[model samples]
Target chain A: MAERCAIVGIGQTHHTARRDDVSIAGLLREAALRALDDAGLDWPDVDAVVIGKAPDMFEGVMMPELYLADALGAVGKPMLRVHTAGSVGGSTAIVAASLIQAGIHERVLTVAFEKQSESNAMWALTVKTPLQAAVVAGAGGYFAPLVRGYMQRSGAPEDTGIRVAVKDRANALKNPYAHIRDPNLTFDAIAGSPMLWDPIRFHETCPSSDGACAMVLTSERAIPRPKLAPAWVHSMAMRSEPTQFAGQEKINPVSGQMCAKEVYSKAGITDPRREIDAAEIYVPFSWFEPMWMENLGFAEVGQGWKMTYEGATALDGDLPVNCSGGVLSSNPIGASGMLRFAEAAMQVRGQAGEHQVDGAKIALGHAYGGGSQFFSMWIVGSARP
Target chain B: MADEAKPVTNIKTPMRLEYRYSAGVATSRFLRGIGQGKILGQRCPSCRKVYVPPRGSCPRCAVPTVEEVELSDEGTITTFAIVRVPSENIDVPLPFASVHVLLDGCDIPFFSVVQECPVDQIRIGMRVQAVWVPKEELTSTLQSIRYFKPTGEPDVPFEKLKEFL
Candidate 1:
């Protein structure tokens, strides 16, 4: 049997469109140091480190992990970099946890970040190559058509996307580290927002943020007394498929479904919608909230929008999703997934503060990337499994 | 700190990279066919699926697709989006309808912009046809086909296009 792993430390920077006050290394160190403080340990206590982020082109940095070794205290220690597009954050944390679960290390630190203000993500995403159609405008443009496909298949209300945007922004008010805390955000504001990509309004899209998130995972035997309760890892999984292939399911990707099924099974969750108290899923676009809800098996096909309409995903609902305001409120692409994972742990540890679900014991963290082809998820609980 | 002696918070650095990208054998064949005002796709022997703008191999079967199949220039829109935001890479006018056209007889959809019709009229299942540029402007590039335009055919039923979506 594998050794148990516990998340005893979690930290994140106050995400914003531009974190100009610090360099990339300084930004990472801020979160890493805070995580170490939470774990009641210093850099020397960490046995290894794992780092992750989006494409280096987004920040005009190549192989940033090599330069960030000293900042993360990975010198003379095992340091690995993971790149799975936006899912890198969640995958990074899973890798760190594996070190403890495999009895390879007592304590491991994992960090993921993105400094989008340094370079243009749009330009980086839309880099033109020879002989190919430059039809895809950006991430929004690429996903809008799939959103339209989902709308046609589900027959969902036209305002479903707007409702999600409003709900997530409202939830952002409770998250102190969230980037966008628009108290005045309303359904009308989102409905009237410019339609940058038809079926996806401006407010429905995530902002380009500069931020970092870090966590410290330790073997159960090495768990130390901390300021907060430790979140025990119940299960974790990662799945991926090709970006495009004949008969591929773009809207409700099969990889995500398989990944969710494996995680829920390993966590002994027969009914995730009831067993899990909260979730922090990747929803860069507002419509993806419903799409992912169905994909993650939280709701039945074509019924996810009803959950939003019925207020089942709100902070006070049965399965409160994205209580940390999620990627919609604060999206540092590289760290967004890790933020979800960390926020899930926070919920189980009762450290989510204002956004905490009442007596949340078990929580789920989910992240998808690269045309919805890559998925990483984990289950955490306050009570050891 | 005095206002005049304030430290610089950020420095602007614009970078550029030039690359020589090869289209490879299969894509070169597809581009050459496009230059000749014909649409070509490669057939996967194992799955028997035709892939337009072929990538030389079938992603699902993991085998080389050497069988060239000519497909209709007409297609049905599987999905579409109206882009109001301007992109540095796309030269199309604002509020253009970018669509995934499932060309007749091909299994995968071809991504391109649809023009000469109102943006609101661009819907899933609408029939469209490729509009090639002037003959003299034809080159070994997909740009030879300027844009796709509505073919005035009845929209394909949602059920028929469900598999493509």
Candidate 2:
């Protein structure tokens, strides 16, 4: 049997398009130090370190973990670097938790960061390869068709995507660390925005942000008595499939569904929509909220859009999703997923500050990457199981 | 401190990488066929699904696809997006239809641009045929198909192509 793990502390940087004042090392250290401070611990207290990021192309820096090890207090200790496209953050956290759950380490530190201002993500993603057509512009170009397919199959209203953007932006105002905080964001503002990829409008897209997120996971035996509760790791799961295959389901990938099913089963969740009090899911494009709502088994097929239209995903709704403003408000590619995971832990720990869900005892963190083929999710709760 | 003596927060470092990419045996054959005004696909022996611009092996079955199959230039647009944003890679004019066309006899959709039609008019299940470059200018590259154009055929029902989407 695996030992229990608890998230004792979580920290994140103030996300923005540019963090010009700090180098990559400095940016990561800021978040790591905050997490260490929140945990009431020092650098030497951590037994191991784990770091994650999207790709070297996003920042034009290869093998950054080797140099960042020292900055993250990994000297003479085990250090690991995780790369799963955009899901690396969630995967990294899971790896770090495994060290504690396996009883190998007393405490571990995990960090994820993306300095997108150093390079262009669009060009990095659309790099031309031999014998392959370069018709896809960026992530949006590749996913827009799938979104169109989802709209057609579900008969969702044209403004459904815009409504998601409006809600997330409104929620961003409450999150101090959110990158894009708009005080006057309206459905008209999002709907009137120029369409970038037909159905995906400008406001509906996630901004390229430079940020970092860090967390400290410790074994149950090493848990510190802090002011706020520690979020106990209830269940974690990851699943992956080929990026493209004949008859593959891209709109709602099976990998996401299977990953969610495994996680819910382990957590003993029969009805996730009711059991999970809060959720922080990766939604780089606004529409992914509903798309993932169905993939995560929170709604029926072709009816996920109804949750968004009915305000069931709002902050005060039954299951508040992305109360930390989500990817649409602050997307530091590599760190985006970990932000979701950390926000979920925050909700369960009652440390979410302004965006805290009232009496949120259970929370879900979800992320998908690489054409929705890669998925990593976790369930966190206030009480240890 | 004087303004001129302030620290430099940003620097310009432009870099470029160049490498030769070798197309595998299966992809080379497809590229060579397209140069001769032909669209070639390969069939997975196990699943029997034909893949356009074959990737040398079937992703699901993880087996080499040896059998070659010829596909029709015309196909149905399973899904599409009208790109209005400018990209450094694409040279087409702003606001063009980028479609995923499920070609005849092929199991998967081939991504390509559709031209010679209004962006607004492009819809799912629309029939389209590839427009190759001049014969003398053909090359062993997907760019040989300048773009796909409308064939004016009746649109395929969405139910028939939903699986490809």
lDDT (Cα, tens digit) per residue for candidate 2, span A50-163: 999998888887889998888888999999999999899999999999999899999999999999999988978888887566899899999999999999999999898998
User: Who wins the DockQ comparison?
Assistant: 1
Clashes of each: 0, 0
Per-residue accuracy of model 1 over A19-93 as CA lDDT, tens digit each: 989999999998899899999989999999999999999988889999999989999999999999989999999
Tens-place lDDT per residue, model 1, B1-165, is: 547787888777888878889999999999999889888999999999999989999988889999999999999999999999999999999999999999999999999999999999888999999999898888889889889999998999999998887
Runs of candidate 2 with Cα error greater than 4 angstroms are B1-4
My TM-score estimates for the predictions, one after another, are 0.98, 0.98
TM-score of 2: 0.98
DockQ of each: 0.80, 0.78
